[model samples]
Target: MELMTFESPVNAVLSGQEAPERSLKRRVPMTARTKQLSDKEMDALERQIPDLAQIATKTAYARALLVSDSVLRVDSGDLVRISLDGSKTVVAKAEPRRKVKVGEVITVRRIEDQTAGGRA
Candidate 1:
């Protein structure tokens, strides 16, 4: 019988292998991770989530502004465009909220950006 060059159980036995005892002895418990916070202890942090989100959005908008890319978000039932300098332009009346149906298709209309001379 011919033995395969790779992945043959018989060949695996012939190849050299590491001793499991030494490998287990080298592992040490990791201590750098932060301790888990209880739900009550985390309430204070959760309260600041909105502030963090706003800051993150501003940072992201600033970066997008560098590339001349517009940010689109729905606010107060309308589609709003956010510029890099933090100016908001109402684009249009946003689509009404609705329950997600099975196999629904969302169509995003892309138009030309006249000011930046780029494809929308």
Candidate 2:
């Protein structure tokens, strides 16, 4: 009696044996989802928004001036001279609108020089 052997694809690969050719096939399904907004819906959304141009710039609680001296000062209610880059701005100091101590940080509305405005 003679013994015969047959090799399976998976077993042949695992045992370092050559595998026979076999056709492979795969099945896939197509799927999709989409939404559309009606013209009425768009018009309703537009009506809910207020006109942006109606918005106004924020009012400042306190005013400030920056001078070339690298000094930031609050309006002291007295006229003060701010000198910047060879220019001067004289801003009438108003009573410190906000409690500000010496050496407090204050942003200036605009950059000016010593000649900007002053009694001098």
Candidate 3:
């Protein structure tokens, strides 16, 4: 016995169609209302999302510091531990990713590693 494969010229039956959020088997009245957005609905959404995200992140960080007295963040390629009393300490050095810089070496390339305890 031999296996056969058929070539599909059509990529998908519902290529550009949107799927329903609710169950297909759910019953609904014929008079059920549906909301449709304007053409610029996505554009409006994209504009406001970043601002909301920043606010949410700031709020969460503020709450975390208030409850735990300290928070950590990566600054200038170094892990910094910040305290509620306006104090900062370098917890660990996060070195920059090392990759071969392309092109001819015309000038002396300085090693840009920020992490401590590495060969010069």
Candidate 4:
């Protein structure tokens, strides 16, 4: 004896057009719910994961005082050097998300890679 394969007689069945068996097992509709976290719980979760805070701080854009057209003072201790043209200053290699002004504050973020033993 040899095994043989059979095809559906109707094209609707072959093309999965709401067959009787499939229609019988209907899908259940899902309901959406919003969840809110308390400030203390959120703080506890942040403390549990120190890297989350580090990542947030690193990605967050901050206003830095432009010491000069080419230099920006992020804080009392940090200074960032940027490229300066006649009237334009470029901070990073990529296009900045926000516009910058000379002799004024600009939005910037510090990008750093945490590596082990100084090797990537």
How does model 2 fare in lDDT?
A: 0.41
Residue lDDT tens for model 2, 20-44: 4432323333343455879999898
What are the C-alpha RMSDs, in order, of all predicted structures? 17.1, 29.2, 16.4, 21.6
lDDT of each: 0.61, 0.41, 0.59, 0.41
Candidate rank order under TM-score: 3, 1, 4, 2
Check candidate 1 and list the clashing pairs.
Answer: none
Q: After superposition on all CA atoms, how large is the RMSD of candidate 4?
A: 21.6
Off by over 4 Å in 2: 1-34, 51-110, 114-120
Error of 4 at 3 (Å): 47
Ranked by TM-score, the better of candidates 3 and 4 is 3
lDDT tens per residue, model 4, 1-120: 333333332332434443343333333335545579899988988786888666544333121112122433233333334323433333334433465577887655545563222322
User: Over the full model, what C-alpha lDDT does candidate 3 score relative to the true structure?
Assistant: 0.59
In model 1, which runs have C-alpha deviations exceeding 4 angstroms? 1-31, 69-99, 112-115
TM-score of 3: 0.49
Using all chains and alpha carbons, the TM-scores for the candidates as numbered come to 0.46, 0.19, 0.49, 0.20
TM-score of 2: 0.19
Model number with the top lDDT:
1
The window of 10 residues in a row where model 4 has the poorest summed lDDT is 60-69
Model 3, clash count?
0
